[model samples]
Target chain A: MVTAVRAWPRPAGRAPAVLGILCTAVGAAFVASLAVGAFPIGIGRIVEILADMAVPGNASGSFDQDAAVLLSIRLPRAVLAVCTGAGLGMAGAVMQGLFRNPLADPAVIGVSSGAALGAAIAIVGVSLLPTAFRVAGGFLLPGAAFTSAVITTALVYRAGRQDGASGMHSMLLAGIAFNAIAFAGVGTLSFIASDEQLRNLSFWSLGSLGQASRDLVMTSSIAAAVGALLLWRLAPALNALALGAAEAAHLGVDVRGLERRAVLLVALVVGALVAATGVISFVGLVAPHIVRLACGPDHRIVLPGAALFGAALMLAADAVARTVAAPAELPVGVLTTAVGAPFFLGLLLRARRASGL
Target chain B: MRGVLLAACLTLAVTHASAAPPARVVSVGGAVTEMVYALGAGTALVGADSTSIHPSEAGRLPRVGYMRQLSAEGVLSLKPALVLATAEAGPPAVLEQIRGAGVRLERLHVRHSPEAVRENIRTIADALGRGTAGDALLQRFDADWRATRTRIAGLPTRPRVLFVMAHGGAPMVGGRDTAADAMLELAGAANAASGITGYKPLTAEAALAAAPDVILVTDQALEAGGIDALLQRPGLALTPAGRAKRVATMDAVLLLGFGPRLPQAVDELATKVRAW
Candidate 1:
């Protein structure tokens, strides 16, 4: 017995203390990201500008420009990073719980690839249509991504189901197939793309947070919040699920319903995130794994903790991405992969070693 | 006696068959279209690819689609007698299909140097059977290029420049063998990213390593992140380029398009490079 990790929901809770620390860390990272840029605005000036904006006409003159820059640009970008990270983290946790495989991620389920294929088709194919039809091309990108994610997930579920039951192995196999098809589609689109279109697609595929508009941030944050809340509700069930499906069933967990809900939740969260920010990889896998190692696999604590940790990680990664090249921003995805690839390899090695493979 | 007569008649027909003016010429690449127009053969043009949007009237011509992903159906529908294309044109299969259809296809060589551009113009003009007009254009262009070169040669020192292609946050710098590199060289400025060949994504470390005195990019790309954002790239802060604040942006098409206006571009670039 793993003692059910009573620290998560005990009368004298330690979860709040952990949450507080994470919040403080996330806040500090946000401030650091804003302050440290090529322009090099001081922390005091940043706060003073922010302070003026909060209370109307507190400070007059040129401070409004600083406030506008911080509020309109950096604030939205930081918020987007946090939301995207939280969404990916929550999706990853849910996926791992549903599949009972620590290796499971949003990418592993083919959601990211599907979204990518959808975006590519929208961007590339729509351009081939007549000029009148081209007016709607902008919406097609995200629309295609969202539609493809939903379709791919539904197909995977259908294909993986055996006697109305889906095992981790079957789901993983289906995901692999989906990813292959999606990638092939993307390749096809790339073949026909113009030099400019190819450049745009390549950049978009690598992922970026530089285009974080206020509307995008708001939509992403809402989607993330909703997804996180849903995951929160499933935490207790997820904990039971870790005990095995049979034991979970005995504990009044409807395994089928839980699986369906978890898959849907993961798909929605991942689809929204990918649609908004392109495919930012590894946050889902890395964040949950870190949280599991730190707090020991208690779903109640792990779910929220993973969300916070993921947000912090993304914020930090984005900050590094923006500041590292100063004027030249590396794609957030590139930075994530540069960090994530090694961590992923280590996870695989650890898993193999533990299994005595 | 009859066999001899038939053979003689066949020989006569073969000898007298003169190549007709391309009744419906379809040009795929923008540079190819410019060359055709410069050769005074725009009257032969029936349709053009999407990028053939220069010379005002070229924009009025029917577009067959993008250069690389050209539709065989769209192109063939134009009923072209000849298709003039660049080496970088098509989805390969489409080009193959057009060739298979027995369309007279001429793939023009993409050139970088002023001399190469002149040679390309001559080759295009000869292909279009307007060699005389082409000779005149070449002479004028060559004179202009030589005069610009002379002005640039008189400069005390050529500044080291980095030509950025596509930049997200980090700069994608042009190196040796690229059109931009050739243009910079022609303008008498040394390319900072000459350590590498062709267009490549420059690592912040590598970018800083080049120690460019002036950062050159297209106007649109500059609009994205601007000077301050470009200067902030991680390892770039330590570079001489970032400190000196030497950044020059020009229109991409004019800077590296290798058209007749290239002399003007070269002269303008020389002026900017020589300023510091």
Candidate 2:
């Protein structure tokens, strides 16, 4: 990121100012996210609904239809977008810092594919169980996803590690190999699903914020908050690792344990995010890249900055996704990819030029 | 006499109000859309989802996107009075929002059986206040259903049938408790993939073991490279049906819709099954 940004370097003493800008962007983006949707609710109504809901006694009754929509639909969706983006972005930042690989994204460990395959199996394979065990309800898919994430990470760790040490090259290759296998498994699972189940599965895999309920928002927020804390706590260690494992160990860092814990943290955040909203791409990857371009490669600044940037970017993309079709919605994942891919490419090109490659 | 005249005016007003616009109805599923049209309530439709592609007119209607992935504002853009959808309709949040907005959202139950289809006809008909049309549609449905059954009733043997569904990767055969299985039974054919409970990937050994006499596919599958591609599949080509080249195809929506046109689909299927 530094090499690429050499041509257009950020001014000195700009970090604080950039952070301030990102904070404001996320704040304004949050309000804008709530204000604009397929529904015609105005900013005034949204504010009023929130204000009313905030006051304990005023929650009585007759809040109006717009209030229900504002409070029930858009608000929760916006919160989820923020939470998911923050989690993914923070995860991506830490992953790049820890792995010391700029190209590494959130699911670089194959959690997304494993989680997806887990969901597919839950949807289709559960019905084949005996009548006593056949009643895997709404939680089944998400539960399966989380479980599969943990298992896949464990398996990848086992395969990539060699006699008390881990290899980044092997780990990445394992992610790729496991991802392919998981997708193939998903393909097999889709075949066994009833057409209705298939449609629902495909609909979910499309990754919409349309499933935003208050409970899901709250749950996702808590998980993301915990994940952010975990990632933030590891920033110094990550900074050490980014300089190379030998130097980090020389600096008194436990290199092997650090690698294991970092991977574990990535798995947890990726699991929660993927299980809740299906798989989202690039928020984690580009958020960090953009932050590195603005704030330099310090993990302490990079991690939190990426979190804010990712949350803001996700909400903005979600807003576009919500209104572009109006009365119809493109998947949030699709919108994010469209914007993230180009920006990411530009960053890569700049990086390549800076490196004189 | 003045009282009598006022009463008559009230009755006339009610009937005229109902007849004038028939209420702006929005349909979220293909079958519900078809049923609305079948009940002569097609003009009432202000918006429809992407799945509502029957009768050509539905195609011309403003689309609301996929049935399961709806947006309330897009659906409400038409300001519809009645929203007819299937049980499969919605991201659930959008449906709730539409209902919260005070539009009457009717989520008709979908069971993928003949009984459910009848209930669907009655429900859509009742929603549109077209009881007579609904009844007449039911009779045509009954006659067609009976005709299909009767024609194949005296057959010496029911051909073992398989429904192959593949968008990508390995193909799968439809098993029990599926629309394909139900459709096969309705057409008086035995489901070849009966040992399984639902759709699953078919192995070459499994395909060979099923020993299907006839293979049915959707028109979409057929269009995706025709029967040749299906027969050329590594696992399927060795099957008895593939070897004999006994493949038939139907429009995916109509074949699986289980809507007002289900009787037609069943008849079309039975005719193909009777051959060979």
Top of the candidates by lDDT? 2
For model 2, how does the per-residue alpha-carbon lDDT over A195-280 read when each residue is reduced to its tens digit?
A: 66798788777777776556666776787788788878777777767778777776677777877887888888778777778877
Residue B72's lDDT within candidate 1 is: 49
- The DockQ for candidate 1, computed on C-alphas, is 0.02
**lDDT for position B124 in model 2:** 84
RMSD of candidates 1 onward, in order: 22.1, 6.2
TM-score of candidate 1 on Cα atoms, chains taken together: 0.56
Could you give candidate 1's per-residue lDDT for residues A155-195 as a string of tens digits?
Answer: 88777766533366687898899899989999888766654
User: How much is the TM-score of the A chain of model 2?
Assistant: 0.89
Give interface RMSD, every candidate, in order. 20.6, 2.6
Per-residue lDDT, model 2, residue B200, is 78
lDDT, residue A289, model 1: 79
The Cα error of candidate 1 at residue B159, in Å, is 38
Query: Mind giving the per-residue lDDT tens digits that candidate 1 earns over B49-79?
Result: 7778767778877777666545444566566
The candidates' DockQ values read: 0.02, 0.42
Off by over 4 Å in 1: A1-17, A57-64, A130-139, A164-167, A340-357, B1-276
